[model samples]
Target: MAEFLANYLPAWLAYMVAGAIHVGLIINLVAVGALVFIWLERKISGRIQDRLGPTRVGGKFGWLQTLADGLKLLTKEDLVPGGADKMLFRIAPYVSFCASIAAFLAIPFAGGDYPFIVQHVNTGVFFVLAVLGLEVFGVILAGYASASKWSLFGAMREAAQVVSYEVPLGLCAVVPVMLAGSLDLVVIGDVQQGWFTNWLIFHDPATFLIFWVYFTCATASVNRAPFDLAEAESELVAGFHTEYSGLRWSFFFMAEYGSMFSVSLLASILFLGGWNGPLPITEWLGLTAANGDIAWYIGQVLGVINVIGKAVAGVCVMMWIRWTLPRLRIDQVMATCLKYCTPLAAAFFLGAVAWQWSLPGRTFFGLLESPAELQSVSEGWSDATAAATDEDEPEASEDQTVSSEPSRKVAAAKLTGAAALQIASTNLQGGK
Candidate 1:
């Protein structure tokens, strides 16, 4: 669409328009997703506690309860403490919300010849983790600027908890990158395209252990229960955002839900098969990139749905954990990360490396072979090797040559393009 617009409009204008559209879509996703999750949390928590939740707001299920709450918040007063640093306090929510939204730029919703990503960064995993870590800064700023002891304490706890958890989180995420041999998330997800056994979580015994570690750290990283010490309402009276109200408080909630969905989607790409389903239904039905453009588009749409479904399922599990388990103390949270998650992630990382080295091309308990397609696509060396093989092959009959030429040319073009991309990515990384 942007390309089409470039024909009629200036290139810069077309790009700006496309970028704005993408931004709007992502913003709506975060806003609407927060609304939905808020309703779900209330309903789910109510059921867990054997009570009805929000029956009066929007009919039987109270579907419009979030909208009602939003209206109420909008009408509430926006107050700044008399002693507060007004500028910092005012800007903090936007900082948090913007940081959460920025992480989605590198996140791909679907994969194909053209993936559904905003920016498509090469080091997507690292970029996301780094951006997510910055969210705590907003909390710290908000707490310190508010001039409240409880808020200051909450901010300090959040800073400590998030910083500590990132260690294990990075370690756990690296296991998949090691197995895939690429830092590009699209390539990582593409490598897992097949049955459920192809998912990184099931690739080996070590990865299975690492997946759990990754989830634990992910939960803590996002400040969810039972690791939500930053917002221990019973103890700290609303924690870091205690003084925040109205739309500003809503921004914090939006940021939280956005981070939740972001981490869940990251998990899907890292440990699950990503946009690919457990079965090869799309492949069987001929709805693949190899088909036609329309077929490819349809396949991509389904891929989006598949990826979103998996992400939503992950969020639901987090909600279940929140309602079912008691919130851990700040001490317990730190101990869980440093003593348990970190060491376990480190051991699992080593085990995964050894397993990959020893087994080579094995997956799923050695019952299936690991796909070499992603490696072949991302490595410039493979293109050189393929060219050499083609040159060394015996001459074929005219009829045979004619029939195979198109496919060979297409393959060569794709390999050359991928190799070029790989080189550019390497240069960019080195420059950084």
Candidate 2:
């Protein structure tokens, strides 16, 4: 669309318009997604406790309950403590909300020649983690600016918990990056493009274990119970946002739910095959990237549905866990991260590396073999290298090509990590 507009309008204007569209989409996603999750949480909690929740609003199902709550919040008077740092207090929620929403810029919703991504950063995984880590700073600011001891304690706990969990979270996420050989989320998702068994969670025993560890850390990272020691209602009043009111308070919830969805979507892309369903229904229906624009568009729409459905499912599971489990103490939260999750994640990372070293080119406990899979994985990089080499030595004779084989082999042999995995897989499959 931006490119289309560029044919008539200035290139700068076209780019700006495209960027605005992307920003609008993300903003709506975060805002509307938070509304739905809030209502869903209320309904789920009510059902678990054998009671009706919000039955009066928007008919029997209470569809307008969240909207009604939003209105009420909007109408409430904004308040700040007299002793509070008014400047920091005023800006904290927006900071948290912006950080939460900014992570989506690099997250791709679908995979194709033109993926449904905003920025398409090569280092998307790291970018998201780094941005998400910044959210805690807002919490700290909110707590300190509130001039409340309870809020300060909550913020400190949140900082400790989030920082601790991020170690294992990064380690666990690296497992899929190692498998896909790219930090680009679209590439990660595309690499797992076949059966559900191809998903990173099923890649090996270590990865299977790593998935659970990732979820645990993810839960903690998002401040969901039983890991939500930062906002224990029985202990602290309302945690970091205790002194906030009206839309300001609601902004905090929006940031929370937005972060929840972001991490859940990240999990989908990393481990659950992103836009790919458990079965190849879209492929069978002839809706694919290769089938022209209409088919590609339809495929992408379906991909969006697939990815969002998985993310919603993850959010619902978190809600269930929140309502069912008891909250952990701060000490227990730190212990869970340091003593268990970190060590387990590190072990699984090593185990996955070793497994890839030993079993390359095999899947499903080595019952299936496909050497071409590994070749396909490395083909993108290999082709780029070949193209660059060809461009640099266009005048080389056939004799030079023959002489280059040994150097090419040496280069291939020097491949390490994911590249090594691909080469080893190819060799093992060839030997078979």
Query: How accurate locally is residue 16 in candidate 1, as Cα lDDT from 0 to 100?
Result: 92
- Tens-digit lDDT string for candidate 1 (1-432): 589789998999999999899999999989999999899889888888898888888788998999999999999999999999999999999999999999898999987658999888977888898899889988999989999988987887787778777877887878777666566788778888877888888888999989989998999999999988788898889899999999999999999999999999999999998999998778988998788888888888988999989999999889889999999977678778777887898789778766655665667556467666533322322333234454532222221222223333433443354344434434643664
TM-score per prediction, in order, is 0.86, 0.86
Per-candidate Cα lDDT values, in order, are 0.81, 0.80
Q: Each model's RMSD to truth, in Å?
A: 10.9, 11.0
Clashing pairs in 1: none
Cα error of candidate 1 at position 165, Å: 0.7
lDDT of predicted model 2: 0.80
Instruction: Write the residue-wise lDDT of candidate 2 on 141-213 in tens digits.
Output: 9988999977887887787777767777887888777667667788888877767877777878898889889
Pairs of residues clashing in candidate 2: none
